[model samples]
Target: MHSLSAKDLTLGYGETVIIDGLDIEIPKGEITVLIGGNGCGKSTLLRSLARLLKPKSGNVLLNGEEIAKMKTKEIAKKLAILPQSPVTPEGLTVYELVKQGRHPHRSIMKQWTKEDEDAVQQALESTNILHLQDRAVDSLSGGQRQRAWIALTLAQQTDIILLDEPTTYLDMTHQIEILDLLFDLNEQKGHTVVMVLHDLNLASRYAHHMVAVKDKKIYAQGTPEDIITCELVHDVFQMKCNISCDPIFGTPVCVPHGKGRSVGANQKKRAAI
Candidate 1:
């Protein structure tokens, strides 16, 4: 069964609808990436799945139960969401921030226990931020800070994790690092990961299942090989592109046609000669 799904979900702000009557099911224990152009409702859809946004119509389901009816803490125990560019509280250490993830698991009558401590430690270790746990979150570099934030979600010990543009503002190296970390979490820990990503090539590289959002609905969704094509990219992103294969991963790669210098055919012939 899908651990997370949206049934006829309609989301918007005021009267401007962003997503209208959308249905999606996130495959359990896989990486699902939502891709689309700006203002195409990718983030809006993700937020609704996490119950961060209230839908105007339809329902979000978690393990076959309606998510809107579930208690906040109960939902927190099963799902963790890292929003886009989250603000770090001033002077908060990484350890302290990560520890906050345990709040859903804690109670007024319950004291901090070994289980909680272990969860926090494991989260830091999983994100490879154990060494920076004592450092202030604001002091870390972009990559380190992103990892620390991921550790916070990890500390929640949920089976499902959702993130909105987790790699935003990070350099290429850091983006790869963050995606690789999430890939490992899915492969090794069997966690269901869903995120909105802007990079088409990277999304194809890491996503086992990909959903392309366009025109307030899903344009297409499936494995990259099955759904990612020149037509889909042009239709969803409004760009012309060639679909190629990644040499290393064999995933579909989008080579967009845009203005750039071109090597003349004569130059290539002369160079070869």
Candidate 2:
């Protein structure tokens, strides 16, 4: 029962309490995607779980113990977190950046070990950035830079990984590639992945557990099949949408009601031209 959970989390900045008394039990060895409208406290919650943000009240627990009470290195060994935007040091190569993830495992007296080298190499390979290892991170394309950052997180080799919007600036193909890579990590290594995703369609396809946050609390949570519906979308996102199943993965797809491409009887008649 390896559980990383937030119990009674009153998360916020200073006195501006955003999340008031929330509890979420992260399913171990599964992909959990947190979805919410902007400023709904989803990313804040993830940071709280990683001990990066202190809760206004209550506790974030790792395996039944309070994460806030644990040593930083101990917490790092169990969980690795990638923020929405990370600042890369100037002139630092990808390998140099990835190697930093191994610092938690190194003692004051111990230098870089064979294990560290192997971990960095493996992480680079896993993220498909092995060829770019020697290149400076700042010089890479947006997608490449993102993959480099992901490789750094993977290199840490933690059982639990938290990511905040991993596909922010990437194109569609790279977004899918990133998600697919994460899916493989969850499946092959059984790493507990909890991330904040903006796209409902991708979240539905990839997440084993979907937690929809709203108004500083969870609006709904369950399998994508159960949680993603017309009512939930309207309630959480405030958008009228048609709920349909994805043809490829049979996952829930939300076709939001708005002025976009025409897809009615007129669309069919126009296509017949």
Candidate 3:
């Protein structure tokens, strides 16, 4: 397993800085959720940490060495990152897409071997997509396609996985199902998992650790039960909210109270007036 650390990292685009002087240590073999309002640099930070974007200042360290110094293929062998919406090549079957994940470990002279085949098969089985291996990825539903992409990442066999909004296109049921699969991957296999999640409740439910981002930096980081509070929600999200223990999981759940006038409340008050 590998531990990820960002040290005084600065992230931005062109000349404007979005987040500066940020430092974070991701726990090994656990699910770490990053939550923040839009434009707060959650995605940028994840990209920087994943080595897809270089930090203007400071560095991201994998294990103990700086990531920027590592070769791309070397990094690919140890870490795999899935962006919010990975594009699927037209006509690519689920099996073909997943097989791409093994490229980092392959050589021209030494092509696909028994071990590579087994990895692909195990990845499909682990993600419960073995039966769909022959299906065209584009023909699958949003949830199934997402799982297929995830299976590809699993085929990489990396110790650290960074996922940006793994639940983006799915309905609530599929969101939970995908997250449950990820949870088992962490709990059962002990792979270090880090993801960006907009749903605070789901983050609390599935994540072993939470990092709240606000104003371009980590606002707070800890167990949901310890760091998720009414004030944190208000400050981080700019929304008043009530914090309560989740009914089933006992983790902190956020109930947002935003600026939009409640239609029902407005009607009731108008009738009273």
Candidate 4:
């Protein structure tokens, strides 16, 4: 059974609908990437799945139960969300931030225990931020700060994680690092990861399942090889492109046709010969 799904979901703000009557099921224990152009509702859809956004017309189901009816702490125990460019509280250390993830597991009757400490430690270790645990979150570099935030999510110890553009504003190297970390969490820990990503090529490489959003609906969705094509790119992104294979991963790669330096056709033919 799908751990997360949306049924006839309609989401918007002040009558400006972003997503209308959409339905989607996130495959359990796999990496699902939502891709689309700006304002295409990718983030909106993800937020609704995490119950961060209230839908106008339908329900989000978590573990076959309606999510809207679940208690906040219960939902927190099952799913974790890392929103886009989250703000770090001033003077908060990495360890302190990560420890906050354990809040859902704690209460007036249940104080901190060994389990919470171990979970936080494991999260820092998995994200390779153990060495920076004592450092202030705001003092770390871009990559390190991102890792710290991710460690907070990891410490939640949920089976499912949702992130909105987790790699935004980072350099290409950091972007790959963040994606690779999420990939490891999925492969090694069997966590269900759903995120909105802007880079088509990186998303194709890491995503076990890809959902292309366009025109307030899913344009296509499947493995990259099955659904990512020149036609889909044009229809969804309004761009012309050639579909090629990644030499390393053999996943579909989009090569856009646009103004840039070009080898002449005769030179291309001669080089081919």
Candidate 5:
């Protein structure tokens, strides 16, 4: 199939290096979730893979060729990226936004074609947003807006897709819905899905391969069953947790030990006193 890799990657903002000398290979036709605590560079790493962020050192390779050396349109045809927060122009309808995904394949003279219309329509249908196609993106709720953007990415019809915290601002129901959609895309179409997810349980449920980022490096990488553990969660996230199997998906589920209003960490500490 397809291959994506980062070699000796050193990425960061100006004067701040987030990841240093890291190497990762995206497993073909698998869902890879990048898990880390806040400010651990999960989004930065995703952007680097999509070539949206320039690396401080090294390069991202697609199919063994340096992505930096490829033309922008060429890359767009093979891969797509959906950022965590995307700007939706005021008054722009959902259909218009999804239509933009076809720009990489269109020409000034070629304009609209059957293929473009089919792609946009398919994306809208796939996202269950077909009825909202005429609605202004700015007027939609947060969950609707997220789906519209996801539809745009699907319209690109790329083999590889990278998303950053796609479930942000979505309720639990919608979160599961979105993850289910991505899972279906991978199983049925063989799209190489790479993403950053904050929810530990959801990550474990949906990820075929999980990469735990710790100390700005890869702490572990493998199947969810192999990579997820009570020790890894505590080590990487610095949060005490118990690893259990998900009843529905048969995947690892992380149960965190936290102190809130009831008995937990704080109650235990007070009992010792």
Candidate 6:
């Protein structure tokens, strides 16, 4: 019932609009993946929805309320955003970093309440980082660091969570792990998750819904099973591919036909001939 939507939304930075007149709905209690080529405004649109960037025209609405009108703290209570490549403070412990998420909940009169402590604890535990709470964030591995950042965001306990490339520095294993964690969050907590992902396979595997962006507009948006067809990939990414069921999950799986191993195999066959 609490959907986030944009109506004729245009977004930009300092006089240049990167994306224009976008109408899209981020369905509640679902994991929505945003996929597009670099510079196609995937991150720009995510930031706009999160209210980190202002809209040039039109409005971004959360539960039928214009997001721009809500006070930052009030908005923070309902929304949390994890940007791409967030910078961690040197020597800052994992617990300390996660604790920052409570900023919106704190006031001059109510500094460190029991509720704050419980939130931080729950977030750390949820991320499986409770044991690493005292370790400096910089000392963690790339995957661990990513988990720490996710934990920080989880501590915010917002109904809507926006993640910009949550798997940037991670290996395949870690990427899947993070995606699984996100999927669980959506399934168990009913947190509406919206993320920008570069990996189409991962998006198809983990997302309940997908949005393909291209040419400053929505190329397509729907369930992965419905939207991740070969035509969509060819149109958005300009690549040929085969789309089939995932053996395990039955989600759409893209087999890119013109890149990597497939191209190598073709070239080797030609050379042999």
Q: Which model scores highest in lDDT?
A: 1
Residue-wise lDDT of candidate 4 within 1-273, one digit each (tens)?
A: 239999999999998999989989999999999999999999999999989899998899999899999999999999999999999999999999999999999998998899999999999999999999999999999999999999999998999999999999999999999999999999999999999999899999999999999989999999989999998999989999999999999998899999886579768988999
Candidate 3's C-alpha runs over 4 A off are 258-273
lDDT of 3 by residue, 198-251 (tens): 999999999899999888788999999999998998888888888988788898
Clashing pairs in 5: none
lDDT of 5 by residue, 1-273 (tens): 768999999999999999999999999999999999899999999999999999999989999999999999989999999998889888999999999999999978886989999999999998899999999999998778888998998999999999999999889988988899899989988999999999988998899999999887999999999988889988888889888888988998888898657658778999899
lDDT of each: 0.95, 0.92, 0.92, 0.94, 0.92, 0.90
TM per candidate comes to 0.96, 0.95, 0.94, 0.95, 0.93, 0.93
Q: Pick out the ten consecutive residues of candidate 6 with the lowest summed lDDT.
A: 255-264
Instruction: Put down candidate 6 lDDT per residue, 1-273, tens digits, no spaces.
Output: 366999999987898878989999898889999998888899999999989988999899988899999899988888899999899989999999999999999888986989999999999998899999999999999888988998988888898999999999789999988998999888888999999999888898888888999988999888888888888888898889888887999888888884355677889999999
lDDT of candidate 1 over 1-273, digit per residue (tens): 239998999999999999999999999999999999999999999999999999999999999899999999999999999999999999999999999999999999999999999999999999999999999999999999999999999999999999999999999999999999999999999999999999999999999999999999999999999999889988998899999999999999999999876779768988999
Residue-level lDDT tens digits of model 2 in 129-176: 999999999999988999899898888889999999999988999899
Q: Please report how far candidate 2 places residue 114 from its true position, in Å.
A: 0.8
Tell me the lDDT of model 6 at 226.
Answer: 81
Q: What shift in Å separates residue 169 of candidate 6 from its native position after superposition?
A: 1.9
Off by over 4 Å in 4: 263-273
Candidate 5, which ten residues in sequence have the lowest lDDT sum? Answer: 258-267
TM-score of 4: 0.95
Better of 4 and 5 by lDDT: 4
